[model samples]
Target chain A: MPILIKDRSMVTPREAIAEGDFSIGSNVYRREKKVVSQVIGLVTIKDNFVSVVPLKGKYLPRVGDLVIGKVTDVSLSTWIVDIASPYPGVMRTSTSLARRFDPIKDKTRKIFDVGEVIVAKVFSFDRTRDPMLTVRSDNRGGGNSPYLGKLVGGRVIDVSPSKIPRLIGRRGSMISTIKHYTNCKMIVGQNGRVWFKGNNFEDELLVLRAIQKIDREAHTTGLTDRIKNFLEEAKKNMPTPSKEKQSDKEKRSEKKS
Target chain B: MAKNKEETVLITKDGIRHDGRKREDLREISFDVGVLDRADGSCLIQWGRNKILAAVYGPRELHPKHMQMPGQAYIRCEYRMATFSVPDRKSPAPKRREKEISKLLGEALNPALFTYLYPRSVIDVFIEVLQADGGTRCAAITAASLALADAGIPMRDLVTGVAAGNLSDKIVLDLDDVEDKEGLGDLPIAYLPNLEKVVLLQSDGIFTPDQYKEALDMLVPACKKIYQLQRKAITDKYSQINEAVQKDIEAEEKDKPAKDKKKAEDSKAKDDKKAKKADDGKKSKASDKEEKKKKGLKKSSKKKDDKKQASKEKEAKKD
Candidate 1:
């Protein structure tokens, strides 16, 4: 069996990648024993297994994914959340709350109001049904950790979901670098929402710019080093903020978007 | 039947047509893919004097829950011609011809796509003909398929379309406006080049059994030729982006080595120029059309009218 395409090369839709007994991966289909690409993407071959990483696409939700979602409507039983996916997510009050929740006795809006953002784990998802979300952290139980529950007092920015892996870098190297340099406490969701709060507004803005740069250059090689140098340059040139203005600057930046 | 056979000569004895093209020649065809900023995928195709802009959106949610398909996504196509696209201004309303073409095009593109992957969603294709000469439906189908592929929708094969005309008992490829109006017969077909499947076929006027077979033979190879152009258009866009990224990386490396005052300033200027070139490489050619639209809609239509009038005068001189 011969591999038709070179590894790490770009391919358009329906272009043949390999023939014969190769294990298929995402964005590829088996046609007459030949593996063909299903989208315009970069093809990767590792150990006889081939996959195509799409350059652009909407996020498709998977189970166990950490996601940031905005509450759109709160009913008596469930809160409808927009998770930046093709399908909406449903967060039930019975599982989301720390204490036992009474649907008839308590109002759903009291627990999680409309337009509030929450960091949640996708508990269940199938193509036929909407994804089910749980705010309860898996290890410690209640939503007390920074990774779960209502996200408050942080700036949330969006990147393309397909570029999330590049943003995170190799084993969190890219994200850790950004966090260490900017001194920002950041949480990145699988759905491409980044929430971070730094000591000053300038650090937050620097993180925002860095993320945008990464998104733009995601397909390029040596991106991690480029971003590290970019962050360093900005840190050296930034004017120091006055201590008193930090608090007000946070409020102003929050209102800008 | 050539009703005005005595008044016009579509093909000369030397095998040249009215436009000075050989019997097998096609009009110039080019594609600019990913030209729209907001669309998920878009393409602007210039086939001869016909200009069509196609934009694709979704595989996203289909509204009105009852209308959602159980096993596959629905293909929704809308074909609209601009009011000033033709010599006579078209009314700003959907006509029966537009609706029929829309339905046929949606079906023409269905088998090529893997619609079942996104069940219950809808893929919407919108084609706007800014200028129409002839064979617009064929051109619309050709561009719509490219737009779908650009949108990253899974496809088994790409579709290509072209029309074959019967002029003075000779089958010719790619009929223009005048030949389409006065020619004896016109046969347009959309084919999946690699798969060898004819997704759409329409016949108008008269064709003997032998002439019909000859037309099909000419049309298939013509579509294959056009398909090569479509593939090149797509690959060229990606290669341009790759080159831009490579240049940016090289420029960044060059900036790191200079420390002297004059040398640093010189490197900075060079870096700026490199970045500008990178931007120009990635920029779509649609910027000119965008500028024309910004100049005022009425003004651009008037400009198109002048160009059409000049061509019309040239055609009269040939007659």
Candidate 2:
């Protein structure tokens, strides 16, 4: 009765009615009542259920969800992808695997090449930890099989996979604020995977610093303002392109139209 | 009413009674009527700390009038307390105390009512005490009176009750249970403020004739104030009648269009029925005349379907 909208990277519950042109992850029914899940995308119709194929990878994590994964050999095709839990993600191609890819692809390099991390879903069993995971639908880039994005590293902290939306804020505005100022290539993994790449090595450290600040002050007000100040101070090393060029580009487009 | 062997005064030179009441002050009494919708009539009364809700049902067709006296209607009164009404919870049902109070209360008010106006009719009064600090019986009487009036039963006058008890030996107006048990004397009286008569009277302990006169005299003003409240309750109930009548009027307005639509359909159907009857007559006469002409020509389309059926049967037998 609930479907994750790939575009917004948010879940739309069954009670909400969509306005127009939305995609349904599956044929949903409860006591003969149909529920509309997503607004638009390629939905894999398997059996009676379906899941949307996201045009972009935008997986927002919930507080406690289960994910599955595989171990790639030592970060070549070698990184192991984790489906659930906070630590031991894609085991840096160094840890153990629940399973492996096809043999034609070399165990170490073919299946998951250097920097290749796949998607996985969580299936937590114990009360204290997350479900250790496996792949979901193939249409989801074959579920969390590492598709494309940076294996962003930082001093990782755990958050309720649930609180991710509130953290993202309205229209990704909060995260966007962090991105605009930090200038960090931030990739949020579908299965609670969040990675950050700085313009420079210093920029990466600065991004980690800001992320650490957010983790400490997530429950406060005026977070965007605080993040802006933090980024403005960090931007001394790497500033942005001049606004004059952006304005001129806008004017040229207006004239062309 | 008689005073006990020991007597003391409630107020001192400071000019305040033991319960902080002024010398001539009446106890606080508040009432609301028609609080329940399903009941024919209902009221809630708060006389100081005691609280009661009374529901009245009746003047309807009586199932059995055998209990009625000759030339008079029967009256039923039930006074019960909720399990949580007192400091300690009570049994689920109204027990011995409730039974006695119901009987005593029914008798206390019976003389004032003119139940003989309608024969084979029963008036049921059910009173429930929610919080019984004291004077619950008196509260039940006042609430029942309002409920009866709310039911639109014709009454001589509204009965207003005020219990004047000796608290610390100074005759106080309405005592809480503690004071009632501890006081030297107690007098519970219900009177008709308009008729100027005591419809109910009960006295505990002994008091001088002068003291009795003083207690009764105190009730005069106290009961008058209570009468005003009961009148307001009845008026409020009548104001709600305005809305009930308005709802019926709206229903009638809605019903008019439905009735008109049905009538229009009936008239239109009458015309259609006449047309159909004429068409049937013409068709019957036309068919009789055309039968001879049709018999002259034979149709051949049915022959192919019938021949196919016969060939298929022959093929099946050969197989």
Candidate 3:
């Protein structure tokens, strides 16, 4: 039951991680008694479980995941939402909208048009069919809160889906840090699209830069502190806006958080 | 054919080939992985004079929907040779040979991948031959596997390839352009070293029963040797990144002392791992040295067997 490589070491595909009756985790496959990595990633062995976290890959749709999707095409009943995954997300008018609107009198596009960014939940997904998306606010964790809805006035930037965890950090520490420092209202989608709006364009730009930095250095450890320091340094150099405008914006962001 | 072999002098009386290599020697092989920034993964392989670039894209949406596999992702591979790659300008158009090789390479790589994970998707591997030499197909497969691995595609094993040829009645390890054109037989094989399976096998020209067996023996070892090089190339890329990260951490530790308390415990654990790694490395090296000596003895014994076979053949011919 000896582990072949060091824990958290970068391992290539087919490289043996451990041997024995170990419970296998994602990105690793079992061959007889030997557990082998199935992707290029950092192999982690915890207790008796062995898993490899892949450095790069497309997002796989998982149930109950918060995803930011762009409406690619609007139909009579369903809007085809591209969730940055292989299979498109199908958002139904019946399930997505709050009000029951007649499709014959008013066009379905009147509610949610094409190319609109929406933060939705993946209610159902399997390999056989496209993932289903729900935009109803009740679909979110907290009751009746507007966590899932069409995003507005925020720049949506895409990062590697695999790096989304790093950007969000351990227990939301990283995202909250960025939000606290830059005063930016941020929505991080598990599928890699990040929607963020700040008091000023400069602050929004700072958030974008920090995210890009995280995406680039996600493989490195101790990234949370580095990002925190970076935001502090970058925020110091920016010119302060009018006190009234700043305070008002700060209050809104505070309320949202 | 016998007269032509005598006239060309591919292998001299001293048993050295025209390029001054012994019968058991392979050409210089090197790999540069992740060369294409836009591609999901890419690799440039230089094997002797042969240069090939391989790029991988997807596990993404499969187009033309009908072609999408219901159970597993489709492996679409295209092997193309650049027009100016050869001495005479090869046609830029896809030829029958190119199409066949593409299909074969794709199939060869399919067994090495875990395609069932991504249903209704396609993993496209594009291999371009920039320089023409013998064993281009073998080099292409080798580079393509590296590219697939670099793309972070889940693979069961990396495919390695090498060609063994029968040159002027003597079997050779790796054949070059001149030898390939004039050789008695050429056998190119793509092998999964860890799995010990032949994913692709192609034979051209002619081979006796003994010659065929001997070629397999030579090719398996050659492919194994190439596999080691491929593994090192992939690891080297990651290790470089690891070094950069390590340096950054050291620099940050010097700047911030308050965080040292937490990092100190982590560092102590890391130091223990490092010490254990050093001990493991030394033990492995000693064992590796012993294995090398054993292999040397086996090779020498095989040479004696080859001599015996040659003598027995001579006597049979005389009879």
Per-model clash counts, in order, read: 0, 53, 0
Question: What is candidate 1's CA lDDT for residue B170?
Answer: 90
**Residues B1-319, candidate 1, lDDT per residue (tens digit)?**
4466666789998889999999999999999999998888899999999999999998777898888987888999999999999999999899999999999999999999989888888899999999999999889988998889888788888889999999988999999989998889999999999788999999999899999999999999999999999888888998898888788878878876652354466456555545676554443334433333334446546767999999999999999
For every candidate in turn, the CA RMSD to the true structure comes to 17.8, 33.5, 23.4
Between prediction 1 and prediction 2, which has the larger lDDT? 1
Q: Write the per-residue lDDT of candidate 1 for residues A1-257, one digit (tens) a residue.
A: 99999998998877899999999899999988889998888899998899998877767899999998899998879999988876788999877777788767888888779998889999998878889999877665665554688888889988878789999899899999999899998888899898888988999999999998898788888899999988986874564554236767888999996
Measured against the native two-chain assembly using Cα atoms, what DockQ does each of the candidate structures obtain, in the order listed?
0.24, 0.00, 0.27
What is the per-residue lDDT of model 3 for residues A147-248, given as tens digits with 9 covering 90 to 100? 888888879998888889998999889999999999899999999899999878888999999998898788887799899888875764454444446689
lDDT of 2 at A197: 61
Rank list by TM-score: 1, 3, 2
lDDT of 3 at A140: 42
Error of 2 at A120 (Å): 79
Give one digit per residue, the lDDT tens place, for model 2 in B1-319: 3364235445577657667877567668777877887676689988777789999876443455456444555678899999888888888776897998898777766665556654445678899899898788888988998777665454555677878876555666777776677777889888877558887788887677877888888878988887777766655554455456456446645865785686576556555545675564443333433332233222223455678889999999999
Judge candidate 1 against the unseen true structure and give its global Cα lDDT, from 0 to 1. 0.86
How many Å off is the CA of A106 in candidate 1? 2.6
* CA error at residue A56 for candidate 1, angstroms: 1.2
Q: Candidate 2 docking category? A: incorrect
